[model samples]
Target: MKEIRALAFDVFGTVVDWRASIIREGESLGRRKGLSVNWAAFADAWRAGYQPSMERVRRGEIPWTNLDGLHRALLEELLEKFGIEGLDEAEKDHLNKVWHRLAPWPDVPEGLARLRERYVLATLSNGNVSLLVEMAKRASLPWDLILSAELVRRYKPDPEVYLMAPRLLDLEPQEVMMVAAHPDDLRAAAEVGLATALVRRPLEFGPGRSFRIPESGFDLVAGDFVELAQRLLGREATAGPRRRGAPRPPSPG
Candidate 1:
């Protein structure tokens, strides 16, 4: 992995806690509107719209629609489905921008800072450029650059999205490591010849959500960003699953 010089991160659940953040925003809105909806379920349904919406664009059924627009579209449908009413256009717009203000996971900022000390760190998320920029500021995420699907007009698991990062960075695919909590994203990146790192986020969809690492083929599997940084920096080589009982890296203070 000596060739790896930069890290491209999947930002949604990987760097930020999307589910919790969305639930917080939804519940706040519910309280203000005197509605008592299942906020968590609402969050899931809204997120469920995410992939199929992106799929439409990826399949060329729609033009290059940014995430903000797609999110708003889903939000409109969800509002009707959940019997939520009385939200004006402006209020709805504000709610839809919740994705732009997600909170970072506990280990993100510090881990990214440490990793940035040795490698170029950027977001290779499907979020639009504006959404990512606002999220970085809101979450205090330290990103060197924000590369989005808006640039390539494609989403993750698509070769175009994975290849776009290296193309924009002027680096070879092998020189960039794709760090994500999702196996599918990493698998897609690996298929495109980029190095892959799996950062486990067991509660990404909330504590009850079941998650399993589908494979152990990633260059590294870490419980958190701090652990990932340690392994990447120490040049720890891995040819199989991470051994049990390795000392856990402390989260940066």
Candidate 2:
């Protein structure tokens, strides 16, 4: 591979453990709501609404909408399914925004801090700009830029969002890389000539999160963000045989 430069990341599961965080927080919400529902199962059902809701937009059945709106639609449905009641408009509004306050995995902040030193790190997610900005402030993520499908008015698995990065950065597609915890997302990036790295997030779905990691379309697979950054720095430092005192190449594309 030509030396890696900028790294774009998928924010939801890759950077933050959306499932576990939501389940944990939602469990607390459920208790406060006096709804003794299965929070984990509710999380799964809520997630189940995601693709279908996106499909509605993708298929033109509905206008383009961000994940926040999609999550709200499902949250209201889930509240009824769990028999949660007595929530006023303000309560419901606060509850619908629960997704915005997801906590990162323990490794996230430290790892991202390390990586930010060696790369032009930014989000390339389906999340809205405000949502990501708020989440970064809340979670202390050191993102250089917060990019979203809201900018492109589309989501991941769509070429527009993937391709928008190069245009904004004024770089060719091959010069930028995508770092994610998903093979499918990597495949999509790689298909468009962008470099790819897989940052494994095994705790993303709790203990049952799959340990069997896939190996494909990934220029490198890292255990977390820190490891990925170190590897990138080392790779750039040694991309070519050079004189002992020669300066290392720059990291950003």
lDDT of 1 by residue, 150-228 (tens): 8877788889889887788777888889999999899999998899999999998889775776659998899899999
Q: How well is each residue in 58-89 modelled by candidate 2, as lDDT tens digits?
A: 88998988888888888889889978778898
Check candidate 1 and list the clashing pairs.
none
Cα error, residue 208 of model 1, in Å, equals: 2.1
Off by over 4 Å in 1: 236-253
TM-score of each: 0.91, 0.90
For model 1, what is the alpha-carbon lDDT of residue 174?
Answer: 82
Each prediction's RMSD to truth:
7.7, 3.7
